[model samples]
Target: QDNRISIWSVGDLGNVGLNGEYQGEPQLLCDIRHNGDVMDMQFLDQERIVVASSTGDVTIFRHHQNNQTLSANQRWEKAHYHVDRQASCGGAACTGVICNNPEIVTVGEDGRINFFRADQKGAMRTIDNADSSTLHAVTFLRTTEILTVNSIGQLKIWDLRQQRNEPSQILSLTGDRVPLHCVDRHPNQQHIVATGGQDGMLSIWDIRQGTMPVSLLNAHEAEMWEVHFHPSDPDHLFTCSEDGSLWHWDTSTNVSEKPSFLHQGGRSSTYFSHNTINQSVVSAWLSNDPTKDRMEITNLIPNQTLSVNSLDVLGPCLVYGTDAEAIYVNRHLFA
Candidate 1:
């Protein structure tokens, strides 16, 4: 953890701090308070973090851990059109963002998803209405295909292959109605994704299978704001919620209990982003696969006021923030 730094953002404030270090007290190396609340963020690399804001802006911050300096650069100002509050959809507001080098994708309340290339002046292509309700998050499954969750907990898969502007497949998070707040796919097994939401429900989904969750459970007292699969450990999951809690979910123990991998030769596949229509690119293990047991969860933070809105998992360490304007550091979350 020598050169590692931790970053977190919530509401209007964001901070970058030295990781695994605190002699007497913890302190921020850089603090950024944006014009509006921060909605979503992703680390581009060791130096840059991409951020999306409620005010429709997507910005990038470059960090220098050696000097503890942070600088900001505007990527896209007024990235989406927030609808007028009077009309009901709470006026368009940006919700989340993800960066995959040459391209960056940002989603928002107005159901807009704009695709920007790092060198381009404006969006290369824009799905003006990706959904009817607010788009909470967007992720690249194969780069050519993307997944989005809306306020209604509806998951839509868009195949960039066609010139048309509609999703190839749409599914619901649950039979009962509950809004979804966040979604994260497995770092290695792209089709396996996790979702957390308004009802505090945590659901594991294998997009290739049927629409229903393989397993679902109440993960938090309040809304589960973020659900992430460890980058290095696929079996472990990390979640933080509005109940002001941070959790370490260790499914590593269950790895040995898992059924054997799906039989191959039963199927074959090929893939990319925005190029070929559905199947030529998007492929799944198969339908009717059995569900595994629920994961083992540890509450790293027992309790707190307001929501733990942001978090990031780094090896055996973790960092998360709460709506109370507080950030927590767990130097040995796994150890």
Candidate 2:
């Protein structure tokens, strides 16, 4: 038997026998540690995994193939250095992006965007610059600009070309000061951006105009968790919330009726959770090819003592890690 992560077939534990799926001696993929809870993760190509943890550390791991299974080759602990005193990651949390090369872009709990690049020998570069705020979400628009949202319901666009003190553009919500939870740019139109906030609102803005949005909608009843633009079209988009709802919006149509459900043929596209421990659900894009719709959800894996902090998906397999010194690369649920 291989001393790797074991795989068990679905059923009661009593049903696990010698004929089960655990005998192949699967490889021990990797072990990722976090000081606090992990908030998000991004994979760079097929070999690296980037993680954003609640302890304000953004780390990267290299994947190696051994015995026909994947395992971690190397790791970078404390990938993003925090400016504030080392404390539990609170307020607007940090996030990572692999925009152009192997640069790790993370928004700090202190409202700064830090960049770390991979050198020729794969060592991460020292953080070059940091922008301010309790930055909730940070992402790239082209290679030179990044869009970010923060606790004060303000959207700021940073021009990396200018080594300056502040962002090139700043936009705030018109009516209320609801902490923005997520921000994204339209996949087709680089000038357009969308934002979701604690006020259960979604708004679209064009940088050509001032900070106020061109289109706004009360997208959800509860706090919005995430929002994304369609990979192929700027007209369509998706959003999810704590209220257990997923909405599909078409920005090209009547702005008053922008948000619609993603259910197919009058069926729900999501499952409802009864308890709070498993209530927080996170979704990530496995592929953004625009030719295919591939996505995956990561959460606590039952029966494993460690808490699942982050996860990734490739084809029909789910790769995840836990708080108790464990990482998993397992098969996904398929029809």
Candidate 3:
């Protein structure tokens, strides 16, 4: 609520025990006051970060690693705003931001989508009425395609290549409208996507298939705030919720190749071949047989009593922030 951006170093989280516990606090590196409430932030590159604000503005900040400080680099003011005729237009909160290198995409409460380049002051493309309801989150399906989740529990795929403002495809949950809060795409499979809703349910979708999600797993007890797929290991997933819990989902056991590993002594050893593994190693998200799909869900933070608002996974480390005004880092996630 203070509207400040702080940086910390979690590089020295130390080793994990056999039972998967680690000790070490993240060291504070720097803090900078932001112009408005920070809604979302993403690392644009090694030295820069792009931030979305409640004031409907997007700002870029450069990290001066040598001095452990940050400085504002560029700003795009009023990128999103309410369209009003009688009253003066008001800024609508920029709810989410995603980075695709030089290109940045932002979604807002105004139901607008803006695309901006890192070095440019103006938006390259703007989709004014991308949805009637507020857009909550977005993820890239491909370089030219992005999927956005909105307050009405609908997911729409927008093709950046097309000049048309309308989405190419739309998917939604059945029954009552439950706002989706966050979304993430599979690291290895562009067709697979995951979204967490206000109902605390996790929905897995195969965009290549029908309009409905393939699986809806009962997850957190309260609103799920964020969901992320491990960048290097797609089989592992992470989610945080307003229930004050963080979950690690392991879907490796659902892969059909588990049975083939037992017959390594015979010609079945050929199953280890790259071509064979690639063909057989289907993501559990696409599994049709629900009964055989085994997924292990572990609560990473069982004692935390405040909402975990955001989380990110890189290599074997997981870092998350909470409503208690704290950040936690867990290292050696595979252990």
Candidate 4:
């Protein structure tokens, strides 16, 4: 249908094209992007797209130019640079970035999440800090807190309530044998958050606690890549791994004396990415709750064959970048 939006992916070698169910074949919209490799591309609402490169530069583009042959609207050189060195780094280096309402936070191999305020002035600043251990992922908990996870299995929670300061809480996955690969917080409740580590572990925590995790759920059979919680449900979570699988779990189901492994068998996959979810599915109560139990049922979309290097979800749609120099837009085409 013409109502559906078109999807596009640009390769590291500068091959940019579109992917979708259009006519007899997919279409190539244009080849305007000129980076040696597109390290990370994020859509801000529907009008603008931001692309980060391995050269430690950032560029902003308007989604659709009036002329189809035209490329992105405006380009900037060395948008994100190390305050100390003022140089560029190579590909596959930027680990995490989050576009908070008015600002954007990005972290690269330098172990710092540089902050940029989206303004007419277009100024950049380092508003906060995290543990300097290979900042793998960074996200905002509500608007005031920033949750950052490093390669060392440590989760740093920075309180933006305090202006331009370090984190107020530092939680480490020290007891677990694996290093955390990704971390995500509950969209509705700032108190709850989840982490996925190298050992295929999914540990959930309450932000108030000093160090103890609320629960540890082994949701995958291999090294876990990412963990995502349903946008509206605090108890419904998803995990993906190199094991070529995506697992969904309802934390409420663990209330019974029965072992969690029986429920752990629920797995789905289309391509391997960081996290997955459904928008309509809201809160789900634990099975044994006195009130009626609510279950958020999400169908697992199939994944592409290339190793998924990065994955992100917005509402019902998911965008993932793979090691094969391709990105995929996996929509619920049938369901």
Please identify which of the two predictions, 2 or 4, would achieve the higher lDDT against the true structure.
Answer: 4
Question: What residue runs in model 2 are displaced by over 4 Å at the alpha carbon?
Answer: 1-35, 65-98, 120-132, 251-335
Top of the candidates by lDDT: 3
Per-residue lDDT tens digits of candidate 1, residues 52-125? 87767777777777777776754677787765434433435689898888678989988899888765778889
TM-score of each: 0.78, 0.60, 0.89, 0.67
lDDT of each: 0.69, 0.53, 0.84, 0.55
Better of 2 and 4 by TM-score: 4
Q: What is the lDDT of residue 48 in candidate 3?
A: 93
Kindly provide the TM-score of model 4 when superposed on the true structure, using C-alpha atoms: 0.67
Rank order (by TM-score, best first): 3, 1, 4, 2
Candidate 2 Cα RMSD after full superposition onto the native fold (Å): 12.1
Query: After best superposition, candidate 4 residue 264: deviation in angstroms?
Result: 23
lDDT of 2 by residue, 230-293 (tens): 5543344666565544555543333222222223245534322122221122111111111122
- Candidate 4: pairs in clash: 252-286, 270-302, 270-303, 271-302, 271-303, 271-304
Query: What is the number of backbone collisions in each predicted candidate, taken in the order shown?
Result: 9, 5, 0, 6
Candidate 2 vs. true structure, TM-score: 0.60
lDDT string, candidate 4, 176-204, tens digits: 43567787877755666778877777677
| TM-score (C-alpha) between model 1 and the true structure | 0.78
Off by over 4 Å in 4: 1-28, 34-37, 68-92, 120-124, 127-129, 176-178, 232-236, 250-306, 314-335
TM-score-wise, the better of 1 and 4 is 1
Pick out the ten consecutive residues of candidate 4 with the lowest summed lDDT: 282-291
Q: Could you tell me the TM-score of candidate 3?
A: 0.89
